[model samples]
Each structure stands twice: as C-alpha cells, then as structure tokens.
Target: MAFLPTTKEEMQEQGYEQVDFIYVLGDAYVDHPSFGCAIITRTLQAFGYSCAILAQPDWHKDEEFLQFGTPRLGFLVSAGNIDSMVNHYSVNKRRRDQDAYSDDGIMGKRPDRPTIVYTQILKRLFPDVPVLIGGIEASLRRLAHYDYWDDKVRRSILIDSQADLLMFGMGENTIVEVADALNSGLAVQDICYIRGTVWKSKTLDMIVDDYILLPSYEQVRTDKRAYAKSFMIQYENQDAINSKMLIEAYEGWYVICNQPPLPLTQEQMDFTYSLPYERTFHPKYHYVPAIEEVQFSITSNRGCFGACAFCAITSHQGRVISTRSVESVVAEAKTITQMKNFKGYIHDVGGPSANFSRPACDKQQTHGACAKRQCLWPTPCPNLKVDHSHYVDMLDQVRALPNVKKVFIRSGIRYDYLMYDKDETFFDRLVQHHISGQLKVAPEHVSAPVLDKMGKPRKELYLRFVDRYYEKNKQFGKKQFLVPYLMSSHPGCDLNSAIELACYLKKIHHTPKQVQDFYPTPGTLATCMYYTGLDPRNMKPVYVAKTYEEKLEQRALMQFSYPKNYEIVYRALKKAHREDLIGNGPKCLIPKNKPKQNASFKQERAHRQKRYSKT
Candidate 1:
C-alpha cells in the first residue's frame, strides 16, 4: 500500500532510525512486481526487515551512497533489470539515445557497469559492510565467461565487483535464506553452502559437497577450447535436482557456484505476486518509460523451457517452468480493471513463454530438466507433455471479467511448441481472441545451418504454423497477421546463409520493418560461439560473421526491400556466388543496377555509417 523509503525523511516517516538494507539500483525506482528491485525489497519488508531504495545514485560522490549511513544487515545491489552495458550500448557497440528504464526515457543516467561501480563505491565508503549482487548482469556472469564488450574472457563478477556474495537465478528464496544467515551472525565468507549463490574461498578445503573443478581462468582465457569445454559443463549443471557444485580456480582464490535454487511451487509463486505493490514508478519522477509496457501486464509464469542458444534465460531462470494459479492471475487482472488509467484493455498476460503454463512433463517435477536434452529444441522430446488447456482456461477467465474489453499477449510465443500440441483449441482461440491485429513470434532465421546454431526449429515448422495461423484468422473472419521476428549476423550465418534467408523472404513476400543483429552478450551459447568460433555443445568449427562489413551485409539481406540496402544486398549476393538473385525476376532480391537513392535514404545511410564506425 506504500512505497519503500527512498530518502532520510521517508526513512524517519517509517519510524526507523536506520534501515536494515539499502537496496541500490541503476534504474529509476518502480514499485511494480515486473521490476526485480520492487519484488526483492517488498519481500524483505514482508519478512520484517526495513529496506530503502537508492535509485541511480551519483557514483562519483561518496556522500551520495552514504545517505542512509551504514545498514545493520548490509547493502543489496543490482544493475537494473538488464546488464548495464547491454542497456547502454547496442549490439553494434554504439551508444543508444533513449533508455526506457530512466526518467522520461533519458540516457546516461547511470554509469556503465553500474554493479561493479556501485559495489566499489560502497566497499570504499563502508569497508566492513557486506555487498550482495544479483540481477541479469551478475547472474549470467557468475563464472569465467566471455564478455563481448571487453572482447575477452573476464573473471567472475564476484571477483571483479569484489562483492562479498553473489546470488544467481530468481533470488526470492535465495535472498531470504541469505538474510536469515546474516541475521544469525554468520560471516559473509562462511555463508557458502546455499543453493543459487556464488562465493569465493581461499582454498577448496571448505567445499564439503561433490563439485566439478572447471578449467582455471588462466586456461579458459588463453585457450578457446578450454573455454568451450568449461561453458558446456556449466550449461549442463543448471538443474537443481541433479546439479553439483562447480568450482573455477583463479590465481589465489576459487569462485564456487552452488546448484540452482529449486523451482517455486504454485502456491509460492502466487504468494510472491500477492505481496503488496504500488504497481507504478516513484511519484517523484514525472514518468518512467519502462512502466508503460508493464503497468497493466501480468506475469503468469517464470522460467523458460525453450533453451535457445542465443538466450540466457536458461542460465538465469533455469529451464523448469514455475507458474501462478489461475485464480491468482484472475485476481490481478481484476485489480487492473479498477485503476484510474484503465482503458478496458490488458496489455499482456504471459511470461518468458506465454503458453508454458506447466512443467514440460511430469518427470521434471521429480527430476530437473534433462541435462543433455532440451524440451522443445532439435525436436520435442518423446516425453514432452505439449498441453495448453490450463493456459486457455486462464485466458478465458480473464477476458470474461467485467470492464475488460480486450486482452493481448505481447510476449514472444514459441510457435514450435504451439505446433506440437495435438489439440487445435488453444491455437484457434489465440488467433481469434489474443492477437492485437498482429502477433509477433521469433523465427530467428530461415537457413538450416544458421537455425541449428540458433537452436530454433526448421523453417518448415514455422511455415506450417504460419499457414495454420492464417486459416484460424479466416475461420473467425479476422485480418490478423504474423509478424515473425528475425535475426541477422548470428553465429554460423555466412553470406550464403544470408542469401538463403533473403530468398525465403522473397518467397513469403514479407520484409521485416526492423532486424536485430545477433548481440554477443555475456554467458550465452551464441556469445561463446561468437568469441571462440566453436560450438560449446559440440567442439565443431562454426562460421561467425565478425567483421563490420559482413555483419552489415547480413543485416541488409534481411531488409533487402529497402533502396538504401540495394548495394549491400547486391554485394552479398555476388560474394556468395548467387548472382541469379539479381535481376528483374520475381524471385530476385535486388535489381541488376543500383537504384537511385533519395535524400532520406542518403541521410539514413550516412547516419548508420557514423554509428557503426565507432565499434
């Protein structure tokens, strides 16, 4: 019902001389469950701990972090909901102009690498206080991994940030357990046995559980093969039910990662969301751009089973599906209907994957996700459950609520998973009810070789889904269309593969308005491939589009219809020895001769060149 204290006066208003924890953030404060800071702080408050928010404090001034003085428990730090570097720079390494998490969509509100920066400031100001770091940035970088921004292998963030403890995964359970230990007078260094956490040690004598010793940092940093091998081991050990502790050696210390925290039960999931949240950004700011997309949206589930190679969700949230009850989801939707800004519309009602309302199979409950297999990748495993009845029922109850005119599912849906379901009831309802004129699904790429590296299904599967989608729309007399999300310049994507994608686009007579170049962020299988030119799953050489020109040409192939990209597409076709694609024929992606560039086209080209030239 009330926002957490953000200032000394508010701390006093809460009748606290000093708070237990100062939760530092790199984003503007928003008291919505969609934001991680809100959930963690509110969860702590629910456990009878007083916490304050220090949102986007000036890192240069030591006094800025000392606003609440030292806390009784310690400090909690997060680099917003995303990695600070990824939030600041695009895949091309060009600085972005707008930051959706900042006040009024402003840029440069927080320094780059805010976790390391903030931790260092806090450590310097209060040398004895403990600093616990988590979020997407720290969770993915908890081991020896490749950093695309640095273009080198970097040590674990716990080592780099010098934080006392690092909590990984969805840390609701992990945070509370850690808090209990600290409150019981345990030293940060000795609190190393908890699941879903990473800690440092001077020797391995303290490691009582069975653990796999990974290749040392020196080995992974110098040898790409060692890096790939190490990543595969870490990737396979993300399961809670069957994983062992992992240790990676450095010069004089070792970073130890415990097995992931177990997935929350349905009751626990509901209780976490049921906590009191103001559900908006702090009133001090006029507006926060990130809240607009999630204000009326509901998160019905957590974790993703679709272990895409380019995604880090599997590494962070784990592969087991954890969901809220249908009653909980309906309760939240009813709350949205009563808001002052309610427009009789609910924006989204899904999570990592919208339709994943239950575990992949009954076996996942007893045993964690298969270590050597993915639930829906290469092909849906024989044991895959492939049910959507619960999801359909949930949506039906939500839309039937009073004052709710429309409900849209904006989260990306795994089309391959949808196609696997034997029943067509969910598919038909999705097309007829949930779509907001256009539905977005990620096909990633069309080429078989590229799709293999991206961990996506074959193009035939997508084509089938597309055909069925159109059929459902026709049955309902609706004009909905599928907006397939495509990626370019991914690992294993050569010029020929790019040409193949262009030809496929020509066959469909569709062009994407915007295309995403594969971003090599930290701790993704795709990033390992981008850095080492080898797939971690199998130690096989893979084609990586690394050079600026090659990446540009690959991206141009996706938007071949643009006149400004005519030259780049032509060059790509010639480079691939596919000159047949250049002509007046219907299948040609470009013309034989260069097209005249208008002023706007020239300006856009010049701007792009200027932007990419920095990287």
Candidate 2:
C-alpha cells in the first residue's frame, strides 16, 4: 500500500482526475491507527471510496484548499488527533513552543480551531460542497460546551463551523454510512437519520423516534445551572442500546444529534486494525515527534468503562468496551517484527484502561450501562465482573511470538479494579513481566472530598493498592517503582485539602516530578464543576480554586519538596493553619527557615540590578 495522494501531482500519478473526498487535517499525516484520520480514510478506501490527503494546508491561502479541484462527495475536516486549542496552548493559556504532530516538532503549522477555519474557507471557495467534521475537537464540542480558553459557553461546533454534518465518536462505521449515503446522491441536510451524527434542522417535523429536548443554547449560555443540567443529561444518554435522539433548540433552528453508533464487535475491530496502514509518517516530513511513541504501539481495544469525571472518553467513545481478538493482536505483532526498523520490543499492547478487556458485566451488553451509576467509582458495583484472565492470556500469546522481546502495558492499569479481582494470576504476571522500571498509575488526589469530586478512589484504597503492588514486587524480587500521577486545584479542594495531599505525599515518601493543575477542558464533569461551582451529579455548591495564586499554591503544595516552591508552600500551609508542617521534623514538607542566598549569588543579583538602574 502506498501513501495517499497529498498533492495535485500525486493525484495525477495515481491516475485520478478528481478524488471522492479531500481529507483536510490539522496535523502532519501519519498513516497509523493511533491517528483518527488514517482509520477513517482507510475504512472509506476499504469500502471502495477514493480519498486525497490535505495535511496541514495553509489556512491563509485560498489556493491551498483548491488544490484538489474540489472533492466529488465532500470535504472531511478534523483538527487532528488533539483539540486545536489544546495543541496550540497550554492550560495556562500560553502558546506552546513545540507541536509533536508537526514536522520536526515545529509550532504554528495549523491555525487555532482549524475545523472552523478550514470549513469556512471551503464554504467560501466551493459554496455548494459538503463539509464534514469529526475527531476529538468536533466530537467533544458537538454540543454546546464551555470553552476554557474563551472562558465562556460557546455554541455547538456544528453550528459555529457551519458544517453540513458532524460525526462524533470513533467514526469507523459512521463515516462509511455517511459516505455511502452521499455517494447515493442524498443531500447533506437530508442525511440526519444516521447514528453518531449531529446536523442542523430548521424544524423537528421529520423526527419520528423518541427524543429528549435539551436546554436550548440560549438557556445554557446564560444560566450555569442550565448548562450543568444539560451536561448531566448528555452524560447519561451515551450508551448505544438505550440512548435517545438529543435535540438542542436555537432561536431559528435546532441541532439534532442521533443516538451513538454501536461499538465495533471483535470481528469489526480485527478488520479495522488489519487495514493496510503505511505505519509511519508521510515521506514529505523530516520527522514527526508524535509518531515516536505510537509507531511501535498497538491499540488492542477501544472505549473505556472507567469513566473518570475529568476524562472525555465517555462523552466521545462511550462506556462500552470493544476489543480485538487475541489472534488479531498477535497477527499485528508478527507484522511489526517484519518491519525494517524492527526492534525486539513492542512498546504497548493496551488501550484506554489497559486491563479492561471486556464489558463491565453481562447486562451491559444487553441492557446498556446504568445511566446514574458508575462501574468502579465510589466502590465497584456488585454486578461488576472482575476478571483479568483474558487479558493475561492475550499478553501471554503476544510475548511468545517470535522476535518479540517484552510486551509492556504502558497504558494505565486501574488499581482499584485490579484489587477487586480475587484471582492473582494476572497481577502476579503483570509484576513479573510488564514493569519497565516503573509502572505509572493515576491516584489523582488523596483527600476524600477531592477524590469524590474527581471520581477517583479514596486514599485508603490507593494505599492498599500501593502496599499490594510493593508486596508483589518483593515476591518477584524486582526493584520496580510506582509513579503516581497527581493533580491539584480540582473542585472541592480547598487550602486544607491541598495540605492534606501534601501530608499524604510525605507519608508515601514520593515526590512527584510533575504536578498537573486541574485543566478545565470541554466535555468533562470536572470542567462543568469548575465553571458552575456546582457538581452536576448533585447540585451542591463546591469549593473551587479559581484564582491564579490559589491554583499556584495548590500545585506548589503537591511538589513542596522543591526549594523554589518553599515560599508558596509555606504561604499555603500558613493560610490553611498548617504551621505544624513547616518545622524540620520528619513529617514536615519544608524547613522552618528559607535557604539563605550565597555571597556570589547575592553579588550577581546586585550587579544585575545596578546595571538595570544605570541603563
């Protein structure tokens, strides 16, 4: 299989006068399954449709969009694998210096909100052509969402981009269905019946299925409570077996989102991964940093059942688990061994939650996930089946393959879920085989109030898991460590809560190198709480650290060991009446007195000040 045509010359070389769809992207094209565009385009090709690549075209040039001479069916636009705003800026709203998705880690290759920019330009260039948008940016923003960068509620991306149709979720099936409909000459406006799609409607007259009317755009934009209510409704209705059509009204029109498409079965998953991907970036680029991590990685599954409050997987991929057969995975591993740059290692063989290899329970397959309940949060549901035998067997087969050295499960392991399983066969094997020096796990916070707000397990559960993990390592006679991912400044986390987390870190004897402040991105329950100061699950007012200084203090408290953070941590501890943690005792996070500046450093500082004064 050759790379897809990216230029007019390549299209001619492929003996095409025109292509069926021009896939406009916001990132450098890397034909790997880790990329959403590659999967969608390859799936279309498998169903006998032609697609031309338009990877990271110049947004300022009208001629760039006209290179393909207009797509026959329509134009497919995606803001790459990541949200454009997130790709361009950090949580602090600072412009990022490097873009891994661009050539050679260069920044500013694509415009911010490329889906809106590209679609608007396409509409201007070819007024009658259809424009379809999907990927993380479009999927999460399919409905009215709170934009952290804008600090305001923005209308649905479907409405803002003026796209004829928006496909959400893992769009393998949705894209083909829409492509078939378009190939059959159905108009874009009339193609609203497909699942996993959001389209604008002037009226709800043609709607026959049962539907729920969400709070209108005006209501959600004006009232925070209304926004929270709307988000909760959307959250509950993500399952395919039971979800209903959702309609959000605007002043002159309505945005109708059909129920999500069913998750891929084992056979379908096998076929999707079996597509003839070139498995590397297009030769046009010198390097793409994003491909390094995923080049040797294999996505064994799709969707996540552990719906963390701060994650967008439930909103996009739903809670149902779809996995490839062990045979399929082994076949991919064998293919990797044959590559020219093949090493003896397979980077990863996991997905969203590594150990989640099947549905939460039998009822989830038939009746759909419970709307108001969680599978593993608070406590594991009684009906939740705890089995890692299949995952163990799969790993066993992969590692046994020829030319394979070690298969690591780099994608997180849900410790609470792992602890629930009485059978220790998988746990024993995991400690024996998968540890690449350190196993990374997310214990977002230790405070019960903060953990509840973050939808994470309590401190006791995490401590128990940690104890068991170390015991396993001791039994295996391996010197492995646990790298716990921590977050600070989440909703319900006050100054005292931050101090509690700092004390817990002191008890654990681990200092995290990086501490992520709670980022309020769209399509998350945590973000809703951050914006509304109320948990959508229960309309109770929650304490939120909104100011810059407070958030900085919370972050500093997590990494209180660093000398640079001593002042901030000291101020935070004092503010929380935690002067007890400021002494030179074993439990103290910082020393009583600040470190004195050396004579040479003081002289250098004074010299710089003097020079500035003279100037």
Candidate 3:
C-alpha cells in the first residue's frame, strides 16, 4: 500500500539496487486506479517487478529521463490518461491555461505529444533499452492517423517515436506478459505476436497472409477517403473473438497490430481492483485537483457499449463491459467509509457509461459484438438485453452500508437506453436518490439528420426521456433538472441545422452554460467524417463545417443568449437565408439592427418623453 518510488532516493530506500521498469508519464504521479499508470505499475508490482514512476519529467533536458540510471526490465511510457495534445489544448486549438492532472492545476508541465516526445528522449538517452508506449495517445494513434493539431496524416506513433513496441487499450494483461517476455531476455522485436500490441518490422515476411492489410501509409496520406476506409477496417476488428490480425505497410516497414486481447473476466476485474492502491496522489504534492473529484468515487466497471461516433471509448475500452462483482464493489465502498476524512457521500460508482453494468447481449460473450451494427444506436438491437435489477441491487447494498450518506452516478447515463427498458424501477429511484439536484445527459443535438450522422438515437427518444424525467421527479416530490450536454458543428451539421438546434433550445427555455465545438481527435468515426467529408459506414457525403468561422458560428448559435454571440448568430441566420429568425419577434433568435436614422428617431422620441415628463 506504500507509494511507488518516484525518485532514485526512494528506490534506494525501498531496498532495490535496480528498478525493473521506469514509467515515464505526462501527468503528475497520481496513484489512483483511475490512472492507467497506477493500475499497470501496481499490477507489475503484484507480479514481483520493481517499478518506479518518472512522472512529468522535464522533456527539454536529458537528465530527467536518466534519474533511475536504467531499468533492468524496460521503459513504460504513457501520455497520462488522456492524449497530451487534447490535455494541452482546447477544441479551438487554443492553449489551455490549467491542467487538472498537474500539481496546483497549472499547465505546461508536460510537453505536447508526450508519448512521442518522451519516447524519443528515452531512445536518445539509452539506445539499447526497450521502450514500450501505451495509453490513449499511443492507442488511438497506433496506426497512421490524421493529426488535427498538426493538420496532417502522421504515421503510426511507433514510426515517429521509434519505440520498440506499442500496447493499446486496457493493458493490464498485456503489460505483464510484455514484462515476462522481456524479463526472459527475449528481444523486443521478437515479441511481436502479443495481443493488444503494435510492433514494427522492417519487412512483411513475418506477417501472416490472412491478416487484414489496410491501405498503405502512402495511400492514406494522399487519399482522405482511403484513411476513412482504413479506420472502418480498424473499427470492425476491435473485438477479441472475431478480430483478425492487422498489418499496415509504412514505406519499407510494416506495423503489425495483433488482435485485441480478451476482455478481463470478472475474476480478473476483482484481482485488478484488489491490487493495493493509495487511492490518491503521491503525498509529496500539496494539491492534485483530479484527486478531489475521484477520491471518494469508484470505477465499478470498464468499457462502453454506446458507440457514439465522436467517442473514442469503443476504440480504447472496447464495446464489451467488464465488471467487478457487487461484492468487490461493496468491499471497496466499505474501505472508503473507513478513510480518515470519510464523508457521508460516495461521489460516483460507474464507468464509461454508468448504467451499462453488463454486456449488451448474452451472445457478445462468445461471438463478440456485431461489427457492422451498434447495440443501442439507430435502434436498440432486438437481442439487446435491457435489465437494471442487478445495478439497482448493488446500489441498494451500498446505500444500506453504514456511514454512507449518498451514492451518485455522475459519469453519465444513456437516457435512450433507459427509455428502451420495459421496467421503470431503477428510473424512479435514480431521480429520488442519485441525482445531485440535476442529472447530466448528452442529447448532443435536436436535429434528426445530425443525430444520424453522430450515430446517436433519434430526437424522439430524447424528448420522451425528458418528458418522463419530469414526471418521475414530480412523483418523488423533489425538484430536479436535466442538464443536456450539447455539441455544435459535428459532421452533417450545417448552418441550417445549427439554427434548428438554436430554435429548439429557445423552445425549451434552456441556455447551455457550456458549448463544445466538435473536436476531431484521432481514431473516431466523427474525426474520420470531419477529415474525409464522407461517412465511412456507407461512403455517403456528410456536410462538415471545417472553417474556423463556420465552426464558431455553429457554437455561437448554441448559446445565442449571450450578447457577444449576437453578431455571429445574426450572420449565421442571414447566411442560412433564415432571416425570419433575425427580426424582432417572439420566435426571433436575434433582433435585426437598424441604421443610424432609426437610432436618431429613437433618441428624439426618448428626449420628447423626458421633456414632457419634466414639464
């Protein structure tokens, strides 16, 4: 349960002459299980590997990476839990001022593209040392991917970073297997067949003929459509049971990605959670803002089945839900209550999608999720299982525990999936107990066309959920609200669709406090659509707002209530030929501005009224 050695001095104090693996990270050393570094390092320790953390090492200097001298096993690097480019910048490509993962919540501690930058540094320092890259940045960019920040199709991160190997997805099983292989004195290049990993080879003779061959890096670079096609092929083969080996040629080298490993079984889930975690940041720091939110929270599950187009969860965590037993979760809850500052509250107990406690259907376990179709999109599959009794029972057990005031499910709930269920027992209780005055749901947009492009359920389902939510709240005699998370300028969203969404917001008297412009990060269906202007699913043309001004206008339309957005909204309305929304009327989005002559007349009328009142 002690903190891992973060320094050479700490390593010496721990009675280790040589460390096994030195983990280089983009984030501050937070030992919480929510962090991939914490989980991977703890799992390695459980298997008797001496590991040390080299978190947020200064990238500009070579001395920072050599602190541990050199690890006996290898080097493990991650760009923290999130991609470094995403962590450092906003959707507008503007620099973000604060990093929640940093101590004191300051930015600039980690370099942009930390995985590539850190690995390149490691390769420079010790050329012979094995460097393995993983985490979101490495996982999503494992192949030739469109880089939004750079605005180019970059080669797979392994090609750029020159790291010997890359592991994708939740890498608990893979990392250990990698350590065992490397510890046995096998060459890094010789260990290429492990699941959930990407390895580079100088030639194609090592690749199996049956493995899927994506369009070469050269082809995908010049052809945006080819990139989309390649992304679809990657998407279809994410499942462990049915996935094929994939090989993509990058010039003279081949980047081979073996099939994803089987999802952790319930037993594995229990064991992973049971690993000793300090459940907070290393005590040397004063404050880690990320810990405050997750200190009392628990991740009851992993992965998500809601394959929304903009999400990377399907690619990172896969669509299959791997869950810990109710007993394991409750045991963690009991441990939380025993903490010194144990508040009466359990902040959250959920995963990628909170309510997805189990797989979508029974068949997914043996046959794998359907590659071509979604579980709860367009429409819920006929075989989709819709039960919440187990989740409700688990929540009941936690609620009944001593010293626990309230338990919340704050991650998110798929409202459409909730509505699809025939039973409503969980719904009534969710409103009564779980909601902290408001429940956050992501409707994304109100336009059916845009929703279709986003692979979300129709607007009709959201409307029904909205109506039923209020009714349920009324029954509970509690006043609560739904905070709808809205996005603008996604693929298939034009100025007219933006206006339609603005009108719907007005109808509901809702002005969103936060508006998210579509951020096309790597390895997403939406990102592919954004880059190609074509839906990879069917190669249908999609309307994409690519220009900065057009994207700003779409975002402004979502929050037209602010005076600053008035000009942009006005321009959008005018350009869309929806001038009807620009006039001074009840249904108008913005008032049409008049010329100086009208202003003078209004001033004269105001003066007359003032003079008459004085007389």
Q: What lDDT tens digits, residue by residue, belong to model 1 across residues 1-615?
A: 789999988999988889989999999999999999998998888898889999999888888899898999899999999898988998878789889999999998899989999999999999999999999899999998888888899999999999999999999999999999999999988899899999999998877899999999999999999999999999899999989999999999999999999999999899889999999999999899999999999999989988888999889888999999999999999889999999999999999999898999999999888999988889889999989988999999999999999999998788999999899888988988899999999998889999999999999999999998898899999998888898999999998888888888888888989988999988789999999999989899999999999999988998898888988888888888888889999888888888887898789888888866774
lDDT of 3 by residue, 323-413 (tens): 8899988999998999898889999988998889889999999999899989988888999999888788888899889999999999899
Name the top TM-score candidate.
1
- Please identify which of the two predictions, 1 or 3, would achieve the higher TM-score against the true structure: 1
lDDT of 1 at 161: 96
| lDDT for 85 (candidate 1) | 93
RMSD of each: 1.4, 2.9, 6.3
Candidates sorted on TM-score, descending = 1, 2, 3
What's the CA error at residue 53 for candidate 2, in Å? 0.7
Which parts of model 1 are misplaced by more than 4 Å? 603-615
Clash pairs detected, candidate 1 = none
Give the whole-model CA lDDT for all candidates, comma-separated.
Answer: 0.92, 0.91, 0.90
- My TM-score estimates for the predictions, one after another, are 0.98, 0.97, 0.95
Clashing pairs in 3: 344-405
Q: Model 2, 513: alpha-carbon shift in Å? A: 0.8
